[model samples]
Target: MEKKIFENLSKICKTINYIDDESDIIKYSKDWRRRVNEKALCVVFPKNENEISKILKFCFDNELKVIPQGGNTNLVASASPSKEKEEIIINLEKMNQIHHIDTINKCVVVDSGVVVDDLNSNLEKKDFLFPLEMASTGSSQVGGVISTNAGGINVLHYGSVRNNLLALDVVLSNGEILRLGSKVGKDNTGYNLKDLFCGSEGTLGIITKATLKIYPKSQNYFTFMASFENLKNIINFYEFISQQIRFPITGFEMIPQISFDLCIKHKFMKKSFFQETKNYYALVKIQLHHLDEAIIDLLEEKLSECSNLYSEIIIAQNEKQNKEFWKFREDLTEAQKLEGKLIGFDVSIPLDKLDYFFTEGKKYIDDILKDIKFHTFGHLGDCNIHYNLIEPDNLKNNFYDYEIKIKHVVNKLIKNVTGSISAEHGIGLLKRDDFLKTKKNLEIELMRSIKRVMDPKGILNQNKIFRN
Candidate 1:
């Protein structure tokens, strides 16, 4: 049956695009986290929208499952395959292309497979930026970012992928093309279909191309790193700066001492920079079109007001220092891998409850799990925390035994605070059950109804977003 299906796919897709080698299948089967690994029958790379349409049409007609993958950098297992080995992976790397960039309209139309950093590099030459950035920008693709509705440091200023997205060209389940939204913006014609698919996680359709909003590059940026003795002080400082400073704050990130220590231990950064580390740290960046004496004076006044709240404050005087501060945050993920087994959580709560959530969540984990360390950090401006659990050296090999209990303890506490279990990270195979547990019955039913309407045969990204 697998051989016959491959033959049919070959007729619609190019021979070079069809890949069934075990090595290639193994590479594309797992996600970035390596949490789930499922073998695939084959991986197909379609070069154009027409090819993708034909492939989807064939899969729908044959009742074969298709997992549309871009970059394969998803933290969740959304882009990974299933355990049955019946699904075929549709890799979109070959379809990468920047169709056009309209500076006057402030939008860029490009193929789905374009890397986030590559697009930003092109836009930088024109003094423009896409504004949706994350740690995985170097490896993540535009389509996957849109599908996941990714949020990053700048979300406090520019918002998530959904905000920057102006339009999308998607291939539906039955090979039908859907052009949603508009390049000119401000369209109230009918139901907003673009939003329905923006974070749909490929359950509704496959995004082939997109029109994204861009903004003029900021001419001046003020970056600073401050250390606090406690999380409450950091929270207080965040609220104070947010209210007092009138300039555009582009980045506001929180990094705990443990995360910083891990990075330093792994040699991701020099320890001499952080001469005296505090309990927690906050990184802030403000972007402006122009910087004047008045702007500088106002920023200085604001920082002085919260001087007592922070123990140490270091402002980036040049571009090199600014990049070094950001490197501290971006290297946290890779640094954690150097430690033992890691279980990471991407969740969001009310802005005011940021300190409380971390305090209580850490306490809950400490009580249940022994010799476990917590490395918590995220976009504190938006209340999203990447609360991760790391196994101790003695218990490194036995971390899996406590995975379920740890998740339960953490998720239950988050629920108590009325927080979302899955924030920017979509409810891929990793968190499907957790999502169902947290969401209301009506909400789940509505989602299922929409899924049925868009994919009746259940061939597109099967068993994702929701459970069977």
Candidate 2:
């Protein structure tokens, strides 16, 4: 049976490459999750749509499953294969191509596997911006971005990946092509299928291509790093900023002092932006287009009157300094990784309930474990923060062994605050059971029904987004 399956795969993916080597097999076996190991029988690369269709048909006929992968940067282990080894990995990197950028329509039609940073630069050169900027933009692919409906720095203004995607070209589980939505905005169809597949995380179908909406480049953008004595003060400043300006307030990131120290210990920064006097801080962006300095005056006035902000760092005496400030925030993630192995989660809660979630959640773990440290920071604008628990300092220690127990405590805390297990990272295996715990039985049944209607034979990314 194995020999016959490989033979059929070779025929369908003739123009592309196939790797059955030991190292190659191991590379595709897991994602960044590293919590569980999943091995794929063979990894197949298809160059185009026709080749993908043929490969899917072959897998369907043989009663095999295919996990579609791009960049392999998923945090929730969504792209990683199951332990069954009954699946073949389908990588979309070969299809990375931007076919057309229609400036008049304010959209770009691109092949699935294009990198986000590459797309961003391409659009910027043409005086348009894709506006989806994440830490993994250099490695994360368009197909995965669209499938996961990724949210990043600019989500406060442009919204998540789902809001930017105008259309999608998908391949269903039964080897059928689906073209939903279009470059045009208004689509009051029978059902909004594009939205459905945007966050489906490849369980429903494989997104091969997409038409994404772009915005005109912002004329003026400024970044500020403000220090607060506590998380409560940080929340107050957020409320103040939300009410003050109506223009594009692109990003508002909250960084606790612990996470900040982690960055510094790893040599992420040399001369600090502000004096390290407070336990908490916020990195904010205010985008404007005008000749008046009134907005800046108003912002400064608020900072002064609030009595919460300990200090504020406005780097840009000129435009050059502002750009430098932006670069510092973007590079923060890379700097953290240079230090040690990290375990983190993407979580969300109500904006007003932020204080309880962070304070109570941290207290719960810190009380139990005295030696370990947990770092918390993320998009305060959209209410999604990354709660990372760093491994113990000892090199020989195994940090991942405590994942299940730690996650259980955090999940319980989030549930108490009416929050979700996942905010941006989709329900890959890492959080599949957690997601199910939060949803009702009927909701799970509905999702299953949708899967059944779309992929009757259960060939596309089987045993993902749900329990087997």
Candidate 3:
């Protein structure tokens, strides 16, 4: 970078906040997946929207690209700069703030930099929660959540960030602040712009703040861990809950035998919670406003009657046990990192096609990889499956080779099943080729048109989503 350019950026933000350290720049440029560790020109921390505007205007004038980043926890490499071009990173972690908490309307307005868990913690004071619960909640900021449209375990009942997001405040490429959506519960005046930006992956603009709907905190929870002999029975049990269960089902998660065993082997879980193990295990949890003993008796009796569908079932004895069950599920992702290379396929398949997809998908993986393993799971209620392929540590240079073949086969199967290439994770640089391969010409043109209109110079997060 030229001294004059650095001086100009220093004028926009404090000179001290502009991080030019090579090591730190490399760290900020990398994604959570340990992929694409390219260096950024520099990383700037803007304190407010005005500073961000000035910095963006500066970049636009200089024809330099900008990568707006939050917690930098996305698996698709969206938050980091591409290796093709030298872009400056606009890290938003310094702007963390909770602007308002509207209890009457059950909504909270917060800065995009506020961590999801921190927002939920503050909402707990008013007896409410943000409802978006992910393994990365502790580090993921609200802005990135909105940018990626993150759908976590609670999507069974609460839906994704797109569903909970009420409004957004964004800083455009030309130093303009664009505000979309209203704080009110209902608004149908014109085209919905908030949804367009919800999963934009920061290509359109930089998200500065958000207004999200919050649900009242549940007082009691009924959690169960069950193993299924027949994978088809999992879908059947899901239907039964939808039609029969009265409680709000927050989480219906599927854990394959490999993932369950991996979690234990890595010590992410202290021990096996199930007495009798099967091919797959599921964690079903319901939230309640208050405890009702009859509710417990009804669920227990219901499980006993439906024993034919499942091989083993264990109801959580208390809140501690319930959290333990959830911890096991949450810890599985971390354990995958320690085990080997993981390629996550976040696909949304129809409920009836899950068994077939799993069977056929595993057969293909096994046939090709030969000695590979799978660390896969899903939010079963919404049929959002995370079909992850784990390549062994001894693959060496072969990991990249296997990754290409695996991605090709898995994407083909997803396309055959009429499922989307991406479910919760948005189209980032990692999935750009696959997204373009699956996207229709009309859809691609529409996105291109929107991109041109929003970032005319294409200075914001260049070389992402749409390959330039």
Candidate 4:
């Protein structure tokens, strides 16, 4: 059956490229999540919209499941296939091409496989900002970013991947090409389909290309790192500064002291941002292009008002220092990788309730496992907190063994604080159940209805988003 499907796919997508070996399938089967590995019957790389449409039609006609994958940087196991090994994997890497760059419209059409950082660099040459900055930007593809609606540091001002996206060229389940949305700002046309594909996680359709909105690059930025005696103070400072900074405040992040300590222990940074350790730290970036001396004085006055709340403040006086401060934030994921093992989480709570969430969450976890250490930090302004558990100190056991049990506890705690289980990370296979816990029955039914209507045969990414 698999051989027949592969032969059909090859005939349909002649433009597509492939290395059809079990070894190649083995290499592409798993995602970064690594929670589970499922073999793909075959892997095919589509080169263009026509190739994608033909492949989809072939799969639909053959009654075969097709899993479309981009960079595979997803923390959730969304891109991986089910255990059956009956699905054909459609990789978009070969389809990478910048379709169009319209400076007049301030939009760019890019293939789904273009890396986020590479896209940013391309746009930077023309003094435009893509505005999505993820730690995995170096490897994460544009299609995956749009599919999962990935959000990052700049979301506070620019909004999520969905906001920056203007239009999408998607290959629907029936192999029909869909051109949803337009570059024009205001389009009150019927249903907003662009948003539906933004975070669909490939259960709906394969987004072949995206027309993204670009912003005029801000010329000046004020980046600062401030250390606080308590995590609550950082939270408090966020509430304080939001009222003062009329211009866009790009980033509001909370970095725990142990995370910084781990960086030093691993020598992640030559000179730490702080000379002395504190309970929590924050990295805030304020965009200031038109502000003059008087406005700068007012900004300083506001900082001084919030200064008493924090113990130490390290302002980025030069562009070099600014880069260093951001590098510290950007490299945090890699720094955490240096730790023995991590139970990764991307949870969210009300911005006002973060202090309660942390205080109660830490207390509960500490009581359950006395030696447990947490490296909690993320976009504080957006309320998306990534609470990661480092390996317990002096433990000689396998950390991955406790994943399921820890997730239950973490999910319960997040629910208690009115938080979402999976914040920016979509419910691939890993957290699909948790996503159910956070959503209402009607919402789930609506999502299921859409899935059913679009994928009547249940062939596209089977058993994802909706549990069967």
Candidate 5:
């Protein structure tokens, strides 16, 4: 935050609005989870890629650092300013625009700053959908989600942001504009350089625009909540239902009974028809291209084939109830937060070892950690679990040492199962230590080499993936 840089930024961003107020700058520096709040020199709101290119070039020339921001709703603080280095944030909110929607290819080209829900709402008019469903859809921007390769409810059907993306327009550290891939359905050209920036976590470059695949909107939908008697039964049921269903399931969330009760306690939902007392609940959703009320009866008949897996099941009577059920599952994180201190772990397990990850992981936590609730919930179809360890009421708020031990042991378990430490949430400042310690030496080195090549001066999002 030198006076020279401040004056230069003021002159350079004369066309755009750069926040000079201390309070406003501090707000831009914070993570959405309110986990980290660090100092930022200033926040520059750019209108388009040209403005961003100019800002990045100036910062690069002066050896100054800059963090690219969009929506600022990341869970892992991937878009937050640095804690160790002085950096400026280039907010992309003003660059919001839906450039094109190709009717033939069924794709939409949009700026990085377009809100996810807003884009989907626009697409819905044309009987199309972006199909990225998440709790933060209303606030999360395209650039932010694509950068983190965000996986949400539709990932089971539509895949991650990386899978849906067809092309990208990015700005590198030295102000060079690199457009990777194209608007084509598939391009088996040389290396897919676009994939490198999809989940780069803002360390290498900034995504300015993206062309993503869109699906035809499904008016016919069915949602149901089934309560399982045991942990093994839930996994068994997921495998069984996935194979039995004709259409790809849009969402298959696994929320434990405790989480469901907590959501009720916090009034995340008024009530649920699926109020059977059980250990686990599977909130399954299916989208049918053709409207058929008989499908519900058919699904019930199929459920009878595996009645041993659960105690009860309730299908939504209408669309309103169906949405309410999904809301209950989405509000789980907030409900858990209201209860006590929550430590989040987004890990992916193989479909076969998912049951083991839960049973064995709980055993380890119970043996060493002693007093904590091992709350589990996530997309069962894709095998991504949001495994959370919560400090319950009556427990003294001293779990710092316990947290260190928990991550160490849990990471080992994930490594053993050939699962990734990061499933959807990319490795940002929060998971940097675990990533460095658990990742292979060669893998880390390769990433470091790539980092060097992309931003040799290490000015872009410094001290993020690797501590420089």
Candidate 6:
């Protein structure tokens, strides 16, 4: 069966584009987390939508499971293959192309394989910006980001990929193509199908192209880091800043002391802003067409009023300094790897309940676990935090023994606060069971119905979002 499928795939794709070697299959088998060790029968790269349609039609006819992949940077094992090795990986890296940029519409039409950073670079020349920002922008492709509905530091202002996405061109399970939404902003047409595929994680269909909204590049940026004595103070200051800052604030993030320590220990950053670290730190960024004395004075006055809340503050003087401050926030995930084995949770709570969730969640973990360290940070403007646990040196080898219990305690706390277990990261293989348990029965049924309607054969990204 596998031989016949490969033979047909070869007839459609070029020789160089079809790969079945163990080395190549292994390369595209695992995700960024390196946790799953699943291999594929073969990997094929389609150059255009017509080729993708043909491949899907073949897979549908044969009832072969297919895994649609882009950039392979998913942390939740969404793009990884199954351990049974029954699936074929459809990689979209070769289909990268910027089809058109309509300045009049303030949107860019692009192929799914276009890297986020590369698109931003191209837009920079024309003074336009694709506002979907993520730490993995360098390796994350447009289709992958859209499928996952990625959110980052800029989500506070520009929103996530779902917000920036205006239209989509998707290839469904039966090889039929769907062009959803439109280039124009206003269209009260039928069901908003574009959103169904935005965060679908390749379960319902494969996103082949997209039209995304763009914004004019900011003329000036003000980046600063502020230290708070406690989490409450940090929350209070954020509310105050959100109310006072007249200009558009592009980014807002919170970093706990443990994350800073890990960065320093790993040599990710050399300079430390404070002589003594505080309980929490907030990174704020504001965008403006011009910076003047009045705006500076108003900002200082606002900070003076909140002096009791913050212990110290430092604003970037130049672009280099701005990047330096951001490096501290962006390098955290990698820095934690140098410490020990880690378990991470991407969650979101109401803005007002942010401090309560952290305070209670930390206490719950501390009560049950011994010798476990916590490194917490994320987009505070939006209420998402990457609450992570680091395994101690003595228990590094045995961390998996306590994985289920820890997740249960943490997820219980999240549910208590009415928060989502998976925020920016989609429910890939990692959180599928948790999602099934936590989500309402009707909601789950609706999702299952949609999945069945789109992929009746259950051949598109099988065993994802739900177990087969």
lDDT of 5 by residue, 1-468 (tens): 466676776665642223446767767788876778687777777788998898899988988888888888888888787663378888889989999988798889999999999999999999999989999889999999999999998899889999999999999999999999887867887899999998898889989999999988888887888888787898899889889978778899988877877788898866555655777889999888676768778887888999999888888888988888887877888888788777789999997888788888888888776768778888888989999888856877575557787888889999989998899988888889989988999999999999999998998988777997
N/CA/C clash count, model 6: 0
Worst 10 residues of 6 by lDDT: 14-23
Off by over 4 Å in 1: 14-20
- The prediction achieving the highest lDDT against the true structure is 6
Per candidate, the number of residue pairs that clash is 0, 0, 0, 0, 0, 0
User: Candidate 5 versus the native: TM-score?
Assistant: 0.96
Against the hidden reference, what TM-scores do the models get?
0.97, 0.93, 0.97, 0.95, 0.96, 0.97
lDDT by residue (158-271, candidate 4, tens digit) is: 999988889998888889998888889889978898898889999999999899998888888878899999867888898889997897898888888877777777787866
The TM-score measured for candidate 1 stands at 0.97
lDDT values for all models: 0.86, 0.79, 0.85, 0.83, 0.85, 0.87
Residue 136 of model 6, lDDT score: 90
User: Which window of ten consecutive residues has the lowest lDDT sum in model 4?
Assistant: 12-21
Q: Name the runs in model 5 displaced over 4 angstroms.
A: 14-20
Q: lDDT, candidate 6, residue 1?
A: 65
Q: Whose TM-score is higher: candidate 2's or candidate 3's? A: 3
On a 0 to 100 scale, what is the lDDT of residue 256 in model 2? Answer: 70
| Cα RMSDs, all models | 1.6, 2.3, 1.6, 2.1, 1.9, 1.6
What's the residue-level lDDT of 326 in candidate 6? Answer: 86
Cα error of candidate 4 at position 209, Å: 1.6
lDDT tens digits by residue: candidate 6, 385-424: 8888888767645776778888898788788889999889
